[model samples]
Target: MTTTSHSNRDLRDEIRDYWSDRAATFDNDPGHKISAGAELFAWANLFRRHLGAANGRSLLDLASGTGEIALLCKELGFAVTGLDWAEPMLERARSKAPEVTFLQADAERTMLPDASFDVIVTRHLVWTLIDPKAAFAEWRRLLKPGGKILIVDGDFVSRNWLTRMIERFSGSTSHGMVSRHQDIVARVYFNRGARSEAVASLLLEAGFENLRIDNRLSAIHRAQAHLFSWRKSLLRRSEHRYAISASAPMTTKE
Candidate 1:
């Protein structure tokens, strides 16, 4: 599908380039890399809560940067395929876990088969969408009947004064980043970062059912708490992070 960005200019190339350039340094963020420790367990627990038993089910990870979540799902016993538009990102992911399949492709239009996966998962991805409605519809097409999707993301653009102050005192994700990061952010569809409620409504309109939004990522937050200063921790608590889990219909909707 032709994706129309907020500016009505195709910003896909710019977005891809931005992430690709950051591929080398992407895992430096505590939350980005899940090696081992409480962080891994916390993430695993969250997935288990949402996905039930993996049981070797076919799972797809969209925009699977460095394959952190993809490898995590693999560890959880899911047959996983990760797709990312950036080759640098896929290269990192492939090196981390050669056993897991990593494909270079666009998440918005994966060019995969219909009903190809039992579960679909993505993190920090939805907010970058050029056309989220189309993306959600495509995800539904990719999932099997009764399949589930988990969207873990945050409203990074819309920060409160307290959160801003905390970030100012501590370090922000913008630290040690290029100017293009903000540039891409400004052009993406969710430029203002329309929190989880907006995403939930988009999913409903896309015909996904059994929708649920989780505002508290307390477990994951606690796991990575050590990485942040007290002020940063407060900022974390203040940030509009969330997960929205929804299931594809048991039967096709007209």
Candidate 2:
């Protein structure tokens, strides 16, 4: 194989292994699981408000760690499929939501047929990608005409004062494995440049239209001072950590 191909393969393996190692404790992280009714309601409302009604829609949750979003979508009556490369993570997801379809696949190059989904959603996944541009193209290809792609991610490498303060009071902590994985991912090309503006440009370059970014989710996160503090603490070791939602349009075929 060519050097570039080999390098990409190595990177993918590194990422997959990183996540596999963390799968056991992935949901144990306070920020990773939604245990409270109010939080679940908030998240459901957030998805509904952004993606519209989920019922009868075919939703693909890319990088669906532990099936969090996929389960939620299924609960809302959507035909949900969760895809991830890490087997351990998929195992957790399958255990949690056996009713939903879970597949082990790379987000950048899913083996599923084209134009198969009405909506694609992902959270905290972009930063872990090696080639987000390629992933966007694949996502667009998988999306049916007029379908939407909802991405929830943030720059964890550049923290502001307010975020730091929140971390201080929240007493949030991270495991060694999580920190190591974050550091490794932070060095990747897309993760290194994971700012909202940069990602928006990528979406446009990938042939998406009607692009929009809603930072209100970030505002909501900041507003929930207690939760935000805990979340911030877990992520404080990583740089460029800030969350936002980005959506874009896909033209319907004639």
Candidate 3:
């Protein structure tokens, strides 16, 4: 988690406060929470496809608000650690899954030990990063040699006409916090949103390889569709969302 400053206060503080305020009701949104259902199975299936079997592998979930993804991975036999900047979100996460080691830390420079995890994962986090390249570099440093990273993100700002209309008709809303989205957007790297190609470039620059993209994100959308109205479901499924996976290079022992 990071922030931008204005009027003597940084965007970091603003974002932290905003998410903390929303922490209580965060799971109310369909995509935000994964309970027992087809949606949960869909996520498990997707992770299995990209990550193979968990097999007690150590995994880190960056920006792990409420720890849902961490818990899912844990259920799949991962030694999961959930990291976030918001304590309120971590608190909720802790209540649900005490076994996970939840840390309140910055995602960009976690300062955790090197070669600490076999896999790293995040969702909807890249677009908000002020220094995504730095974050990617840090993530690479954190992973063991030949480890993998799974990024679930999108260019949330740039939308087609149909998406715009659907969003407008759906009247989508955030956590009811003051609408500082544009203000934060102005300071972040991906103001238009974290498109796959742009992010792939960053990953390559950061020394990650084997870049793979999940264009449809069909499994997630299909699972979440029933939770919303028809308009909202269409909007969700039709959005330009995606997932990307990249690998840290293998190193030979000296």
Q: Best-fitting candidate, measured by TM-score? A: 3
lDDT by residue for model 2 (90-138), tens: 9999999999989999998998998899889988888778888888998
TM-score of candidate 1 versus the correct structure, residues matched by position = 0.91
Candidate 3 regions off by >4 Å? 1-9, 172-178
Which consecutive 10 residues in model 3 have the weakest lDDT in total?
A: 1-10
lDDT of each residue in 1-254, candidate 1, tens digit only? 25534344447787788789889989996678875888899899889988899999999999999999999999999999999999999999999989999999889989999999999999999999988999999999999999999999999898878876775676445644546777778877799995999999999999999998987689889888888667767877788899899999998579
| TM-scores for every predicted model | 0.91, 0.84, 0.92
How far is 205's C-alpha from truth in model 3 (Å)?
0.6
User: Which whole-number lDDT from 0 to 100 does residue 116 have in model 2?
Assistant: 93
lDDT for 111 in candidate 1 is 95
Off by over 4 Å in 2: 161-179, 218-254
Q: Which lDDT values do the candidates have, in the order given?
A: 0.89, 0.77, 0.87
Colliding pairs, model 3: 3-11, 3-12, 4-10, 4-11, 4-12, 5-10
Off by over 4 Å in 1: 1-10, 170-178, 252-254
Q: lDDT for model 2, on a 0 to 1 scale? A: 0.77
Worst 10 residues of 2 by lDDT: 237-246
lDDT for model 1 comes to 0.89
